[model samples]
Target: MTLTTDTPYALSAPPASLSEPLEGSLKVDIALVGAGFSGAIAALMLARRGVSVALIEAAEVGHGGSGRNHGQCIPVFGYLDEKTLPPEGFVLLRDSGRKVFKTIEELGIACEPVQKGWLNAAHDAAGLERARAAHAKYAGLGKAGAFLGPDEVEALSGVRGYLGGWVHRDGGHLNPLAYVRGLAGAAQAAGAALHVRTPLTAISRQGGRWLLKTPRGDISARAVGLTVNAYGDAAIPPRLRRSLVPMRSYAIASAPLKPDQRRAVLPGGVNFSDTRRDPMFFRVDESGRIITGGLVELRRGRLGGPTVAQAGRRLARLYPELEGLGFTHHWSGMVGISARQRPAIFEINEGLWALAGYSGRGVPTTMALGRALAATLVDRAEGARLWPHDAPGRIPAAALIGFGVQSLRGPLNKLRDRV
Candidate 1:
């Protein structure tokens, strides 16, 4: 099955050619399934350490969530209480965003990365309080964050209704597809073999190695890492599949804004998303057009038409100046949501690993997780310091609960917006 869907990023970026699909049996120290940011970054890291790595993808690189997200790269676990995070997880989340930026710079990946910062605007008094508390928590940890009152929020966002918000100075945005493609190139250059259009049909262990069977051939490796995220299929273990709920996320891109409109909206070119349960995020793209996205409910295995219309309406409400503006593109993709609403790292089998459930914070977090996983595979001592040794277990009926919550959240979010 074709995994890639037509999206603005796929049309704009130059096509990348990593390599042909696997045609015969190949042996490597590690075989990474999925060519999204996580798999590609892990491949690059491992290859740089002189490990034989084979990175395989079912479709073109970044064809999944990596290429279709809103592109905001902020710290993770934003909606969750800080006290619940494990010490190692806390450290990883705190440093992941910076690690992504540093890696991009050091690798010279031209992904149009912008470090202006991310603004978490508050839609109501309660939202403002939550933002303030989050800011205080980050501040207590020596992270640079600021609470912007109504006036400051309006000045920064050019939107009038926000009561207040918090700004994470270290957070930013980038062109995700370009970043993933660049990772593919970097990994291949570092001596890792990248096989595109190669889907793993099944995997089994034999003779202390993993045999990943593809349509054209098989790959033998000491270890396997699955980074397919929401696009995971029956090929993955049932435990991993049951641990995530895939939700459709919809986005729209407006025609390039006129000079006056650009000056009045997001003048500093910062990205912003509200603190709503089902939030809306907007950022000024490279072409000066407003790119916005929000959660949408799926019916009959597709995002309902009204859900897309609601997104456009939400955009207009936030920026009345751009009301009735022409949209250049509309697209949707699936994101993996965990039961606990946090990212999940699972060791599916003794030598097999997987990471998913970014919960809409995949950009920076995925790369960071990939690096940690690679470090662990390359050198246990070095990797253990960056990631926890305990792997996450399956969450019972997570998919059903997640879907039900999302289904209920849609109308409630619309009502909240009206209020």
Candidate 2:
């Protein structure tokens, strides 16, 4: 058991690893590492196309950030066209991402999928104006989004502290784990072999084929896809690893609230995010429990781990109607983020490809990337339109700079609350 990358967060609770390494060298048309949405969807699509596929997971399916994190299925790409992205580039990203949400409905993978959309609430006048600016951009592109004022925001969200916001009509919410598992199950049903808990020790290409050395043994494949997002094990290039900085995010699910409390918080049950750089994003589950999350506490350090009662208390402060509601579950997990705040898809080598860096908008974005990568592999089809090619390049100082920026996020968030 030689060590590899020092990725924190062990398998919190395990049902046992479902994987055994390659006892004998086996060959396949494509090998996908990671059983999350991106890898699973691509594996399923390729296998269905009669391509031999092998799906590998370092841990159990959905054990990483995929299964963790808040289950908001909102479809807005996190990046904007301001200083970070060009106008044409944002149009491409926004339009393509819009199509990705459309595909989810077409696939019918059902995980309580909703398309009623969400709001990006403004905490101040300046934020409200920015929301309007975003609204204009989406409107120019003919996307079904617009600005809403304080009255409309209050009417919709039932929250007190909001100046206005933008509404994305096509965005929605879903169960993250269930959808990920569905993708994995689809791949298996389509004749792909899945190996879980078989951590890859190293990967190297030989004879135009990639060899994945795992704990149990080795497997060879003509092509490979790396879908492990934030939990960067050293199995990949340092450059690619630097593209995504892992950050710990926390969430708390309260015990089923009384009917009135539920009505008070999530009036119409539309998902919601805020203008805060590290905004508190939350929604009510079907079980009538409030699921809320935000930036990591300054005292909690960078690696978000087992949460404490303090998180629940903070949640209570935001929506005081639910004070003393008694939180049933509290936990945290890491999410992969790109400095450009957009996802990237690139060819790593001759036949090896990588698709990751969703910047915390992993739900719909993952589905979108999965379909595009699958199409790119199967027949050089056009699903590559899911993400624009000329998107912003990685910021050189992204790794260390991101850490420094996020380190101050907690305190800055506290300041925003006062504003």
Candidate 3:
């Protein structure tokens, strides 16, 4: 089966409906913006609890970053320092991967779920030291992580690396789009109404409820959850939009590798990303294709031909056995980032909530956050404390700041990798 699309997840995703957009006025207990992972998961969890939920999406389900990501279910925050996470945050992050798998199994989602370990390879001695410290810190917290020696790293990931790194056993990979679609199906089955191609243009308070004006209709919700992430600029409140800097990320999938070629690479079928500043991540798909991605320049919101070619070169360099392997798919998506480098979950109003800035850890992190958000809305005090309920402070000239950061990231990463 083909593995590439403008949104690749649709290729193998179980058949799902486009869902008619909302028309006229409707009222619900909760109206979720963005039918991506976060919103879909929240809808499913809340509906399962008998809450009336309406999930509105500008585009079809999984069309955003949910369908475009690398699909690794990392157990830790990508951009946050381990020391920065509180004890409770550490526990949440530690079990986030398992939570994702558990949810999938409970829902009986058909998405391929793999539980092989995740390899964080160290490119240099300094990287090795950081990895060692990370492993030790997690171990101190009674988390499941271990530092791999050079030999162990090589055995787990069939590539030449200077030093060893850490492995999170609970971490794994999945088809992100398929998973999101599965969640959407589950939410709908649980009595949640899903409206696709229905972008929210405004959110205003109406008496005791929030009125969400959509292109096709308006939804009056007792509680609203904005989970649009990078696409929230026009659809969400200005304060929340100003706090996020959207960054474009790119990925490519090579033609299925020969059996010998696959064995020469990720023989253990574990997902991997190196410790470089501009780290590259790769994992073998069920079809034996090597899927990899990293930071790349975007033209008109998409990766240009040159950037895709550069990704192929980078992949070949990482695994010499895959040199000259032609890529069968190239795609790009936007990820919302915060200056703080961690996700933000806070109240937009008294009852309206918003969550964003998973950085690049959306796979498992979003799942965990979604569940927490659902619980919070349901008045579950335990879930209310899953993440801090404080506003992510505004960044000055967020658009300009995002542009500057993206422009410098590639070059700076290259320089850091050399050091």
Candidate 4:
């Protein structure tokens, strides 16, 4: 693989090639747009169940946020702008990560799965209370998220300044790009027709089937699922795209830390995210590099670069031993900011469905939701029971998001946390 500055560090090794676009017009039992986490899993499950399915992608598999996430695979929802979550959503969220890990073991995917657990470190006493509350909320649902006092927090992270934290042993981190690509490959081997660089340009209902238009040709499908999340294009309904506020998220991997430095920072190989709303999260890659991320400050369709700079500064503050290390990789991706702040399944029209808005929990949760989606498409009652979803709603001032609202996210998040 040709190395580029924008290539994520998680995919340091050569990647498995996804399928090239199809040649002629085709039909399938279900046509899934976006060969990311949800689409790949749905395609795999559907094909294995004796259903003909086409998993299509505008780019290669994991080309979107699926491959570009922070690699934290926790099974809890964060940043939902709702007062209460529906009961079914909780059940799905609780079981999501296990399904992801199970598939990894079953498929023997080499995505570097680490089961060391995740640390939600608190920055202060108030943050400590919030951490406890967050842990308690999940613990009530039968999750084994244990609360950590100051010493445990420091001991696990090998860093200072955290007053307390919570450790969820059930959750861990993995190389997301490798997992999605492996999943797409497994789906292809299982009889799902996988296509990359083949985008759905338009869609309509003809008679009883859905007509999907691609640059390749028009393909007819008995059912259609748009699993593009924040990457949806004109092919989907306006509401489906409009319901999300695409926020810019950035991540970077520092040049490999020395053995002593690695031993002193994130030494446990666990993912660590702080209690701030604009939270700081980091992990350790197999290369012994410190992988971390923050919100991007964009200017004229390009990165302003200060976001990664701030991330480096913040890391130094937390772990002064690595104060001068420079980053070897820095890249940004759009995270779907849901109107309600949680990922949900949506019905665009009869026989047409969408899975969008993962907030920050796409890695673990997408597998469960994707399997449920495919199960539902195959007319299994289990899917409906697994993820009964909410109706779509437009984000107020979502148009402003294209203006300066997205640029304002960093300031707003920091300001809100100050209050």
Candidate 5:
């Protein structure tokens, strides 16, 4: 398989048909743009229902944020308790996330997923209070795991920086690329025509069917679903554009640590993150490698990722026991954040739809949204209910404001230390 932007990341190359140059215009019952989890799952659902689907990609599948993200399967609804979220929004997010997680387990995709849950560590006195308050709000939701005090958090995380933590047993981790590509393979098996290296230049309705103009070829279908969240280079529905803002973060992996060291770092090999607007998230890999990530506003503009030393230094600050650990790899990717910091799924036109903006929580959300979108397409009577159509809004100038925000993160951290 030759991987293209239209395919998933786990496949180094795209499946045969998609890798080759498209000869001429083609036609299908449904045309999909973007090949990440959402698009891939949508394709699979439609194809399984006997819809002839064509999927177009601008780059190799999973190359975007889908493949480049921290592989945490967190479905705990962190945004639910945040001040930015509306009361009804919190309930919706939590319920929706729960449904998504259940669906993945039911499907049995086997992407090495674990439903152990997440640890939201409080790094300060104020953070501890917030953690307790967060627990009160979600207690009625009846999630798994216990909210711990400072001492308990230290015992679990093996780090002293945390004052306390909230543990949601329903959250977990997995190999993101593998899970996304699995959906692609399933879609192919369902009879969808997958096209890679074919970027959609224009999408418009003609004679009732949606016609998508691509660099290599064109696909005409009765309906279209645009899933390109961050790479919104095409003229998309105005609301989607306004709903998502692309922000970058950096991650680094350390060489697999010896058993003792790994145990000393993360006792249960659990994934954890602090309670910062711009947070530092990390977890131990299957190989026992400690993977750590943080908001690296400093390198937002420059091309390469943060050095191992930079990541190491941050790790040392949080987990001083690993001050001497050596890192193995470093990378960075974009995350689509909505102005309201929530995921949205809605129809743009009569048959055209979109599902994007997971904020930093894409894995489970995308999985859930993709399958929901697929179900909606199969039964239009339920489309509006599944993913209600809302007015499209404009994304503020995130790139510009993001640059400034990133630049200030380091200074802000320093100031907090002094206080």
Candidate 6:
């Protein structure tokens, strides 16, 4: 089958459609836009707390980048450091995968979450040093983190040419589309009304509450949470999209490998991503297929163009079994880049918030911070906490800068590997 943009290989099957569009005016304590991972979790948490909440989505649940990724459940952030994130936020980030998996078990979400291990491998001297330092930081957080030698990496993962790396046993992979759908369902059951195919066209303070305009009807709520992110370009305000530098993260999946072929790569059940500017990451999914890819476009644009040929070439570099392997699917999703390269809850206005810009680490990070955002919505705390809120700032000439970044990625990787 040919690769597609609308229907990714990870969510090839038709997802059960969510609730219909808003048909009449409604009032709630809190209104959330975007039914992806962030909004779903936030809505779920607020609902459980007995807060009247409504989750509104432009499309069905997980119809955005949430469903289209390679589905790796990475716990730690590469770009986000302790100094960058708050102490409470650091704890949440460190135990991210465990928290996500715990919720999956408690809520009985059928996302197929697995926990073998997740590795951050290094390719050269600089990368080796970074990995060692990262391992020490991870070790300080938990005992599940362990460093591996070059030979050990080669043995655990059938991939060669790696110096050393760190692995966290709690991190693994999951079916993100299903996870989002499950969370939406749980949130609905908990009394959070979920409205799908409901795009927010306008929002302004009406009286004491915020009035959100939709295609079919209008909604008035005391507070609003925007989790639209990259997919929010058309669904949300133009200014919201401008605040984020849009980028596409692409992935290609090889034809389901034979049992023996699958066993050869990532045999230790660890997902592997190298230490390069333009990194190559791969993992064996439950279907026995090797899924991997990370190539942003030359500009802030789309997820539906064409899969890069480079993805297939890099896949073959890791496992000999995948050499000359036919790719069964190719897909891409847009990820929003923030100013700080960390997760932030942007305070767009009084009682109007936007939570986004996870870069490419949305799967694990969203769940941890989503809960924090929910708490802040209910309790107006005076001090800093797990979910840090900031004023929204637009990236000047984001498209031009994004183009320059993508163009330099390849050369930067080559030069860095040499050093």
- Per-residue lDDT for 33-122 in model 5, tens only? 888878987898788888888877787667677777778877765555535544534444566545555655765554666656678899
The C-alpha TM-scores of every prediction are 0.90, 0.82, 0.91, 0.91, 0.83, 0.91
In candidate 5, which residue ranges exceed 4 Å CA deviation?
Answer: 1-23, 78-110, 235-243, 276-278, 299-307, 317-320, 376-381
Model 2 TM-score (2 dp): 0.82
Flag regions of model 1 displaced more than 4 Å.
1-5, 78-89, 298-308, 379-382, 390-392, 396-398, 416-419
Candidate 4: count the clashes: 0
Candidate 4 on 82-200: residue-level lDDT in tens? 23543554565676776678888999888888878778899877788898888887677666556777888888899877888887766888888888888989999999998898988
Which regions of candidate 4 deviate over 4 angstroms?
Answer: 1-4, 10-14, 78-89, 298-305, 380-382, 402-405, 413-419
Candidate 5 achieves a global lDDT of 0.68
Clashes counted in candidate 6 amount to: 0
Deviation in angstroms for 405 in model 6? Answer: 1.7
Query: How much lDDT does each candidate structure score?
Result: 0.78, 0.68, 0.79, 0.78, 0.68, 0.77
RMSD of each: 3.4, 5.7, 2.8, 3.1, 4.8, 2.8
Model 2: CA > 4 A from native: 1-23, 78-110, 300-319, 378-402, 416-419
Clash pairs for candidate 1: none
Show model 6 residue runs off by greater than 4 Å: 6-18, 78-84, 298-309
Error of 2 at 67 (Å): 1.0
Candidate 2 structure quality by residue, lDDT tens digits, 24-46:
56688888888887888789788
Candidate 1 structure quality by residue, lDDT tens digits, 1-419: 12223556765565675489899999999999999988998999899889999999998898888888877788745633446654665677787787788888988887878888788888877877878888887777665555677898888888898888877777888888888888888999999999999988999999999999999999999988888988988888887787787777776666778887888888766788888866777888777767776665554224434434565577778777776666666678888887566666667787798777888888877776788778767666666566555456566776676677666677687687667
Candidate whose lDDT is highest = 3
- CA lDDT, candidate 4, residue 200: 84
lDDT of 4 at 189: 93
